[model samples]
Target: MSAAPFGFFGKIIEIDLTGGDARVLPLDTALVADYLGGRGLATRLFYDAVDPQCDPLGPDNVVVIAASPLIGTTAPTSARGHMVFKSPLTGVIGTSNSGGGWGHTFKSAGYDALVIKGKADSPVWIDIAPGKIEVLPAHHLWGQDIHATNDELTSGFEAGSRPRALCIGPGGENLVLYAVVGNDKNRVYGRCGGGAVWGSKNLKAIRVQGKEKIQIHDKERYQSGYDQALYLLRQAPVTKRLMRELGTAGLVELINVINMLPHRNFQDCTHRPEDLERMSGETIAKTILEKAAGCYLCPIGCQRHTRIDGDDGSTQRGEGPEYETVVLMGPDCGIYDLAAITTANYRCNELGIDTISFGGTVACAMELGERGLLGAEKEGGLDLRFGAAAELEKLAVDTAHRRGAGALLAEGSYRLAERCGRADLSMTVKKLELPAYDPRASFTQALGYMTSPSGACHLRGGYAVSLAFFGGTKEIPRFSLLQSPIAIRNMQNTGILQDSLGVCRFTGYAFGSDPWSRMLTGVTGMDFSVFRLEEIENRVASLERLFNVEAGATAADDALPPRFAETPIVVAGEEKMVSEQAQERMRRDYYSVRGWDSEGRPTRALLEDLAIAPRAGRAS
Candidate 1:
């Protein structure tokens, strides 16, 4: 027991589920200085803890959860937790982030990170507190839905101070490739099959509670940055008013306006104006929204707590159907019934499923059915048709339980389409399903998805749509090849910095890295200036690339599906498509800008220059 860093506990807990043994490892000051925390720290730890080619769902896979130094401070939306592991779905690095009390509480429990490896012989959950850790049996909690498990695990604590719980439901237990891990009942680590990884290890939940406070080295510097951040957030329309009024679903109408909205598995971005209105954010706000909420210490308040009428004539209350969920499940599936999408959204959350992937998978299935690909017998009598709103709710349940056709969908869209003998039909990149945005409308976005380490993720990529609309002076031409590669690289780096800092992505709409660098330096008494932060961002990006390369990724994997190049979507009255030539050029330029080789591997010299040592043998 030694004194920790000013802003960190400087401790990591490594738990072996096989023997139920836990050991405390001292966090290195150099590692903290290089990687900061959250995604970067977790990735560095995970890379050393598991073989690059290890089975993602096997005992050898490592799950690293880390908190940034900003978590226990007054930083806006600083409660995010970053989870890194090899993805069961994509077979690349899986980096997922979540917002809730869990990360904040986990840091409060006197540790900066928790690394779980090996597997339990039976169902279990981990309880963590200051100076205490336990691996407890959770057989009774097995097969329970997310809400129930959360309630059952978090009960009996003092009011307002209940320990936070992160758990999966039947989806994870069945090893659905796109299952999520839920926290705060609604907030989730909602991508890259983290839930399936947890399920494979027989982990049911992780409960944490503590009250340790982080020390700020310079209160004056911290307050200065905090004030500037708040002022800018107030000045930004998206953060100040739009999010609170309409939630992320507010983007429904806006994205449609930009021709970025996908319809019917991205056959085209065209949609009937009336249909868009039916499921738009305005409709949700006026129809079913119960209230707006925010994550721990967040001011944007973009969370949508709403109620929808069930087919059984009863009202059900739950969280979103966010913009991605709404479009992917509604318009992408050609289903405009808001109530049905909302109901299905609730089911996905309860079942611990990633709604974005599930929706994309369903849309792919529908496209296959339309093209006479999904055989009637293979469908198990399910509709599997676009605009089949009646079947959306049932699909959620079936997918989670691996029942009927869900067994195929449980493998995700790539496997499902490949099973149907049409791998090209799957709207995916690197096996992870695409989000709601159609990449054809924006070359920068298309490049982002092509180069994103996590595959087709807007957040993990660049969220380039934000630049098109709300990037203020930072906005660039969406279709400029000369500008897109560098622009997207910078955007992705900004995202890396934000994720590593445990901050929200939406904050980019208001401000950039300066305020965050100030706040981080103020709290940690470290020189996290903009230049140093950029270096760290490049280091983390290259490290992630190194992991993917060792895991068998190549330049070919950095590509969009053929549909983007084969078909055209009209943007601003001009037909647009990301041609193979364009993709290759952008990909090559992106690799060059990232200091990677043309084959998309981090060059030895570049790695050495970043001071990133080559991966060593697995850690004990």
Candidate 2:
């Protein structure tokens, strides 16, 4: 295969823990050309290596580290990475994208991606530098929390660098399926059980550092394109305000406006109207935000660094109570104390647990408590109620440590609910709990939550961006009852493309301005224009669908939780609803647009057009 200049490292690193072997493999340039990078590359890799029947937490499972052309670039918000794996929490494929210095470091470390497989018999940590790789024993670090692990590693190396580290905490050590790998303290590749996979492998952490300079094919042109893109981004009202005011937490109010905020395990979509403004992003920004931080070379620093006033007259500084964390652990779980929520956010960071799953799981427990399914005995003698801030923190720590009832909650809401014989109490898709948004309030996101490779999540394709960015109507399409299927497909395809590029979707606001496309052309000197890139994006989306099909996912898998279809939100004294027929029709139109059959399987012709060859077990 020819070298992929288009900002691609054109190399894949495979680590075999069982054999203690590592090798640099060539990335398929054809695949790179067709699928782009990040999630696209990851899906293709999973198609080649993993079987649908493989246990998600087993040694055979593959965890993909993917970076794209824009990664490590001067392009605004371009430093991001995706960690893709089959979810232990959910039986489905999952991809969790995160922002940090890690992607940039990995890209500059001379590899485009890392595919790790096979379990190690003993704990180990891999330190990958620009040209060197060392697999070190991690026996002593086996039980440390994520923050302490990062701290010790940084101090031990004496590199005078606080290099980004992705480490599993006690949650992962105890095999919690919802365990997460945290880096940049607060940022996480959060949704999937990648942490459990790491834990099972006896891998403590992956510490990476790279001093290698990023090389662009046409440095001058790249700089020019980047400058122009930054200008447009600065002018975008939402993007600008996001930078100046709330960072990404700005979405809190927007979700509130549509009454989509997942409150009390989604038994209610809106919080009490009086508390709306107090719990809004605007409030968080005004009250707690102390500063903003950024990663690597990005100019738009959307990460809010805040200090929350804890009880006992002390304070704790953390990354954020971003919209999702604020809603999921805050109002959703019934904790309105911003300080308490921030403390919980910090605790999750320190413990390396995903806030979404951690908080949602607690919300599920609270709902069960309210329904009389769980009381003192079931909760180990603590009153688990939504909005009990003290209990929220207790549960947070307990879940991380896997103590008492925390053991059950740590397994994720779906499994926990099943164990308690109240499956309806878990607000989730597949097995992962839904993020902050209520699907009944935003049908596009409902589709996003349901069909995301991961379980219920918002990152797959944020439909709120549809209303906020695209000239859509006042409300985010709440019922995928009509055009949502097609619109969602478009968003998913573009989302994959954006992820492949390893650039922030925030740059989409600057689309057509040629900033990112120019960076692509300049970095690798690949002759790509924005229009052609869109075509590649389309092919990548189709490729992902094909891979999922080969892995046994069918049209039946593309479905919302039954509650979403059966229970309509009572808003403005009217029923806001989505019907089965509407979803089916929308999905049908979506399939047609993507050149797929009624079963939502990609057609042979479509595969050929997209240069995706069918493997032996792939059904026609």
User: TM-scores for all candidates?
Assistant: 0.98, 0.93
TM-score of 1: 0.98
Error of 2 at 480 (Å): 6.7
The global C-alpha lDDT for each of the candidates, from Candidate 1 onward, is 0.91, 0.75
Instruction: Name every residue pair that clashes in candidate 1.
Output: none
- Candidate 1 lDDT over 1-620, as tens digits, reads 44556889889999999999998999986788889999999999998888889999999999999999888999888999999999999999999999988999999998999999999999999999998999999999999999999999898989867899999999999999999999879999999999999999999999999999889999899888999999999999999999999999998889888999999999999888888998888999999999999999999999999998766899899999799999999999999999989999999999999999999999999999888886753647544789999899989999999998788778999988887789999999999999888999889999999988999999888878775544577668888888899989988999999999999999998999999988999999988999999999999999999999999999999999899999999999999999999999999899899888879899889988998976656322
Which runs in model 1 stand beyond 4 Å of their true positions? Answer: 1-3, 376-379, 468-474, 616-620
Highest TM-score: give the candidate number.
Answer: 1
Q: What lDDT score is found at residue 390 in candidate 2?
A: 72
**Candidate 2: regions farther than 4 A off:** 4-6, 156-162, 375-383, 468-480, 615-620
After the best TM-score superposition of candidate 2, give how far the Cα of residue 67 lies from its true spot, in angstroms: 1.6
Q: Taking the tens digit of each residue's C-alpha lDDT, what string does model 2 give over 1-620?
A: 68655576778888888877888888877776666678777777766777767888788888888887777677776778888777788777777888877888788787888888888899998888777777789988988888788887766554545466778888777778888887656677887777888888888888877765556789998888877887887787756656557776677777676667777788777566567667566787788889887766656677888887756788778788777888889888877777778888888877778888888888888877777776443746534777788777667788888888778788888876776678767888767888887777666766666556555766674444454323445443455367566667667766777787777766665564367677777887776688877777767667666656756778876766667778888655668655676567766777787789999888888888867766536564
Listed per candidate, the RMSD to the true structure in angstroms reads 1.7, 2.8
